[model samples]
Target: MERPRRPSFSELPLRKGDPPYSAWGLYGADDELGTMNLITPAVTRAAVAEVKLGVTIPLDLPLDAIAKPFIPSRVPYEHKLLARGYANDDEIRINTQSTSQWDSLRHFPYQSGYLYYNGVTNADISGAEANDKNGIQNIARKGVATRGVLVDWCRYAKRKGIEVSPFERREITIAEIEEIAEECGLEFREGDLFILRTGLVEKYRELSHEEKCAVAERTGAEAAYIGVECNEVSARWFWTRSFAAVATDTLSFEAWPRKNSEGWTWLLHEVFLAGWGMPIGELWDLERVAEKCEEVGRWSFLVTSQPLIIEGGVASPPNAMAVL
Candidate 1:
């Protein structure tokens, strides 16, 4: 039998077929996997070609790296060891999203329905106690082994003499993305995971506690985050390019408490997560991978992420790694 071809852009409104952002019926009515379905067999085969050096590096931050939890609500990771006779067991308690994490299908929404992917209402999430609905656990089985593309915007911007300060809510635009991709001579394909580097994690690690506090104060409402611009152009750009998901080395994928002048609040999240059912990775540790990519003059690689399979869980740390 022949393999199924992915739907094209002309096919809008998923009912006709799979549209640019809507994959509703394309996967199935009961499907919870979302854009991850883009990781087709052909795509996976292509990813293997990137692993020529056999070098591996982790893409996650230390769970307790931050002296203060940026998000006040989340509890810091705690480890407890128990000793019984000569045997000992350990217990680790942490907020799934305290460190590097993939925001699952249930992580965000405008209320229950004003916006949510595939008509997932409040009742749908509530009814499925064990997360028979869209849950992170659903994709945990696959463990996310596929092609990863790094758009080193920070370095690209610096080389171009573009001022990108980590201490401000600077919005990296779509034009920048195009420029960086062109500079790297990379053409993205469907289901490819995008890892955007803005030097956020690097600076955060370098700053003193007082300096960190100053930045947090200086950034104002959302805390100064360097990330992609939140706008329709950017959202459409990502959707049309067929990105499976996007990860960033920043506090939030977009600036915090982010809103465009046009009043599209968290537009990327509203579109990508709430509308398209795509995963969003935040605060990934990309220093080592970035360094490796620079040394090899290559950015794409075989990336893998395995999240904890917790039913009804909102988010989980990305046990993510890159093989080059």
Candidate 2:
């Protein structure tokens, strides 16, 4: 039987700058015809065989850089204690921004309309409790089950004898990612998670405040450990191929001090979260994973990521593992 023609990006009545509703449409007709849900229920039961690769944010980690300033110290001791104790659990703060996290749909809003997922009206996303119930917090709890491909951009750069300083402006293109994958003899598969390691976090931690500021100024973007790029073609490829998620060892999925409209506008976030409803995992610990992959000379592994189940929370620290 002849397959029906796949629709073109322009054919889909999506908002401008919005990522295509079906990434498969970018490849060929029939790409979008496949019946496969990227986020499946099976992921929840997937055995966890790998070590957790998320960073434990220092209790004193500055929240200003990533989020609004935390003012607990300014609050009255009794109220502060009450809030920080999570209603008596002094060990757990009720709202400390300094924690491993993910941004929920409510993190950003478009001037037009639309929350993380398309067709989900803002009215449908109101209220912290309501948003948390249906936001990234819940989606993350389902866990991400798939193979994970680690592309060590730092190692690749080192081999090339090009000292790409994490402190310096670094922007990895999709072509570079593809080349690195090819060099590593890795082949991407459907329902895979691509984790790009750029050695940003290590460098960022070592840099002096002045150095960090200098790097940020030079890049015109905040100092980040890693970021993502698709260059139209790659973006199209990712969408059509059914990747479950894309994460990085950086602060964001894109380069620090982003120069394009995408970051400030949160276009990629919208595309992945709202248009495609895919989750983005950032601030992962990739050094160990990269070293392991290099030692084994293998690039692919089974990846397991399960986020905390906090109803109405926007993001959660991913309990991620990579099993070879």
Candidate 3:
């Protein structure tokens, strides 16, 4: 299906009675794939041209990369070996969000009204009648093969002699994002995955094992990291760019200590995931990919990812890779 031309940020809430800055009903009432609908056949065909070197850069951290998950309640990954006639089979269990993951439309909701994307209610996702509406399976079934634009904020800050502390509340403003895109020679396109490298994984590696575990112990307000500035302006920029999804190396896609939006880490989450049906990826290991981009003097590549096809699942690890 051909997607309609996106309306400007000023012309949001395309449907009457919907929240401001939302694109409800833009795809249709029963739309399961939100912004992902933008990943059309033409877009995928164009992205294939970006695979010049055939070098695939893995974007996922090991399922057990983190000794402890940032959310204390989240269970760490466990692998059990099953032996059968000298061969071994493994049974792995994990909290999808404990590592690199794609937060599906079901993960967050319109904070004010408790509505998910396309008006999916809490009961619609988890109750006696809960179905696969807005489930991660929707994305998995369609798959993701598109162009990915990398905005290396950490590298940009270093070039400008700025100290970027991933352990603190650092904000990358919209202006900075625009500037980085320009410096990286990128032109925003529909269906492009906006990838931000905040150097969080790099900093995480620098911490001692004890420090690493402690980092996960901190919860809520105590967790802080560098990330995109989350507000109406940033939301507008992302919507205008028409990104299929947005990913970051930071724990939170938006800056921590979310002092801007009245304690909400990102008001964009409401407008994007719950309102626009765009996915948000977090805790991606971009260190190596950033190095590869630098080596090739290019910031854009062909990215492919497949989320676990679990019906009614809220999120899943993005088995993602970039081909440059």
Candidate 4:
């Protein structure tokens, strides 16, 4: 399948009275795949060509890496081994979003209108009947195979002598992201998977057990962390770049406790996951990949991910891999 031309950022909301910059009917009223639709056969083929060294890196953190749930309401993973006469079976229960995950279209919605992508409402997600609209299964069925670009913000920060903490609500501007990509000699392409390494996971590894617990205890406005700015400009940049998906080592892809500056009040979660029907991958394990990119002196690679295929599931762990 060849890629189709999408309307520019300026040509959004496609429908009047919808949220700002929403691509609601771009794919069609009943469209479920969202930006994953951008990953056509040609895009996948181009992505496969990025595999030069045949290095495959796993992008998911261990399921139990975060023993405590950053969101207190979420349950920590539990495991049970069932013993049979000659074999053993294991059963594990997990809060999918507790670890590394992809926030599906059903995960969030436009705050003002309380509607998900294509006007899906809370009732649509939690109604009595079983509805699979905008489920992660759609993404799982399609699978995400595309060219990935690793924007190593940590490396860029070090070289620029900028001091910032991943544990804080520091916002990475779009200009900075463009600069990082330019510095790495990379150009944005439609259907590309934009993977950002903010060193949040690396810093988490340095925290003491007690400190980790304390960090996890933070909730609501207190659970502040570093990530991309969640504003119109940033949203425009992302849409124009035409990234099929985006992942980051931080807890959320956008800055926590979103800052409402310059009249920009909504979170990127609202804009991307809800408005544009884009996926947001968080808590990805990018340490080794970042190092490998630095050593190889190349930033683009082939990336593929298979999301859990739960029919009405909201989110899931991305069984993702990067090939270079």
- Every candidate's lDDT: 0.79, 0.55, 0.89, 0.90
- Checking candidate 3 for backbone clashes, the offending pairs are none
Query: What's model 4's lDDT at 264?
Result: 79
Off-target runs (Cα >4 Å) in candidate 2 are: 1-36, 39-90, 94-99, 104-114, 127-133, 208-226, 261-266
For residue 295, what is the lDDT in candidate 3? 88
Error of 1 at 174 (Å): 0.7
The sequence of per-residue lDDT tens digits that candidate 1 reaches over residues 58-101 is 99999877655567767868989898878999899888877899
Please give the lDDT score for candidate 2.
0.55
Instruction: Give lDDT tens digits, candidate 3, residues 112-163.
Output: 8889998899998888998889999999999999999999998998999988
Per-residue accuracy of model 4 over 1-324 as CA lDDT, tens digit each: 433568988888888988877899878889988898888899999999999999999999999998687888899999899999699999999999999999999998998878999989888889786478999999999888899999999889889998888988989988899899888899889899999999889889899989988999987777899999888888888998898989999988888877787987888898899888999999999998999999989999999899999997899999999999
TM-score of every model versus the real structure: 0.89, 0.68, 0.96, 0.97
Weakest lDDT window of 10 consecutive positions for candidate 4: 1-10
What ranges in model 3 sit over 4 Å off?
261-266
Question: Ranking by TM-score, best first?
Answer: 4, 3, 1, 2
Clashes of each: 0, 15, 0, 0
Q: Candidate 2 lDDT, tens digit per residue, 91-186?
A: 333232233345554444444465344444566567443433236555554556666778888888788886766654467888788899889888
Model 2 TM-score relative to the real fold: 0.68
